[model samples]
Target: QPRHSKRQPEWHQRDQDELVVNQPESATLDESQKPAYADQDSGSNKRKTRGIQQENAKDTVVLSKEISEDSKLAADKAMEAMGANILTELKEVQTNLKKQITDQSGLITKEMSEFRKEMGKRLDDIVADLKDVKNRVEEAEQRITEVEEFNMDVKDVLSHTLQLQEDLQTRLTDLEARSRRNNIRIHGVTKGEEGDNLQKFIENFIKTELSLTDTTLGIQRCHRPLGPKPPSGSNPRSIVIHFLEYTMKELVLRSAWGKKVIQLKEKRVFFDQDFPSDILAKRKAYNPIRKILKEKGLRFQTMYPSRLRVFYQNGPVIYNSAQDVSDDMRKRNMFEAAGKPTEDASQPKPGAFSWEGASGIQRWTRETRVKHIQEKLRAFKHNDNTL
Candidate 1:
């Protein structure tokens, strides 16, 4: 058998509306048609419908595949373009970043060079300043050394000058003391009573006291030395008598030495050599020691200008100054004081016994200062006793 061929019917809207109105004709045809023929038609119609549906499906698949191919090609082109653009942008960004890095590196290198130069210049300047400071320090040290040397020379010159001045003063004082060797100060003499016959009256008194009437004693000026007169009703001014020979003065002093009081017209008087004030002060300092010697009956004599010569049993012991005498006496345990003796004599004397609450200055103890003060006070008291 041959395969059955089928045709699909096309129905318009007007043809379907006309068939609806002609339904009796369709019924009469159905009644007259054979079963086989009707089955054939129906099968043919079903086959035609299936064939149309398959064709439509094949066409739709082709169209869809074509559309998908077009869309995939367009997507591929777009992606290529986008990828090219992204690659170009990335290259540009990389180039720009590389250029910026290069520029910054160059700038940093230049800045570093400039900084190096600046730092080098600063270091050089600092080195120069340090050198200058070192030079200045050396110069200052040199100048200080020179100043110290100059000060030393000036101090040496001052010391020599002071020594010379002291020597000159000592020589002058010695000369002055020697000059007054033949002079005697007759204390407690009635002022203005000696008159023009002052030398005659003194000679008469000397002759009567010493029995030197036969001796021709040469007399110099006899008068009161220039000074403030004593207040009225006090003792008369002292008479200063100058003898031409030192022997006559010595004879007068030795003769009057044992006498407690000498009378001039029933008024008591005394004779002493006219010594310098300094020598008088020094002589007064020896009185205590002298009294000690006299009491012990030791042979001691006051030497020229206030030196003391003690005739110790061992030999002659001479003391040049009051300090020397005092030191020697202390060494020999000659006397004792109420307070303990100071151990260190080199320290400066203190102003008082209680030095607490005082400024922080090293000072001698009370015992040392009191010893000096007592020495001076006793010396002054001795002077009063002599007067």
Candidate 2:
């Protein structure tokens, strides 16, 4: 229960100094320095000395115990003070470390918040751009649909217009052909052979060449076709003869058909019905088919305005175009029957009527030509009588 001191305890230092002084005193005292009773108290002095030694040892033990107790108390107090200082320092360090951690956590949270906001803004921008692209794609699809519809309409209109044009062309060709029904074309006559009076010259030439002196020919007009005249030795321009009456024209044609060959001024001539150039072109399209039919020995007749009447074993089939004829021939397995053509097949036949003059008629026997002419004449006479 002693009070604590900063320096060493004063009681401990005083005890040490007393022990030193007493040690020197006990060591300096001698036997000669003992008093007059020394001899009489020698035994007593010896006993006293023993008692003093025992007392000193007891004192020393007591002093040592006291010093040791003081030292243990001081050490315990010093250790307690050092422990209190260390605890205070540790508390301060922990508080500072906690504050630093809180500050760092706040800074990190702020940065994370900013990053999240930026990422959200970028996402919104991307979504808006995607919406715009979707709208544009829809608009493009709508425009494409409109274009497709417009294209379909244009195609329909174009198809209708083409059909209408084809019909108009057909009607025009029919009218042109009908207008030239009573006209006759005379080919292979020399240039200027008809002289100034072309109508009279035609009438005279027909009557003499066809032996039609008894028949009356009602020739309304006669003239060459409107074109530049041919050079010498080339083919002469045709003479178009327009008859006043269709029946008289038919009669003349029938008579001309009866003759194998007709000559005018010692040159061979040809007679045929005149048709429009369009009709002529359509008939010319049948030339390849006609050659094929001729090679196969098939009987086929070219009707007016480019119609073909093919005589088949089953029945007679009529075709308006060479393509139809070809298809039918293929179906009947007769297309290959024509086979390869000879070198001379492409060449024109001698004394044969030209395609422009005779509507591309094939060569026929004299009897067949006569028979067809008779039938046509009878039909003409019946129609005339009916009118």
Which ten residues in a row are the worst by lDDT in model 2? Answer: 340-349
> In model 2, which regions exceed 4 Å deviation?
1-128, 155-163, 195-197, 214-216, 226-237, 264-267, 313-315, 332-337, 340-387
After superposition on all CA atoms, how large is the RMSD of candidate 1? 14.5
For model 2, what is the C-alpha lDDT against the true structure? 0.75
Judged by lDDT, which candidate is best? 2
lDDT (Cα atoms) of all candidates against the true structure? 0.72, 0.75
lDDT of model 1 at residue 193? 67
Give the RMSD in angstroms, all C-alphas superposed, for model 2.
Answer: 15.2
Report the alpha-carbon TM-score of model 1 versus the true structure: 0.49
**Residue 337, model 1: Cα distance from true site in angstroms:** 6.6
lDDT of 1 by residue, 1-387 (tens): 111122222433454466467544333565556454565665765786687667667755666666677777878999999999999999999999999999999999999999999999999999999999999999999999999788767655655665575577578778988899999888877876667788898888788877788987788888887754466998887778888999988987888877767887788889888987556766777777776566667788888777899988789998977667668767876665422223323222445432333467655454345346545545554554475
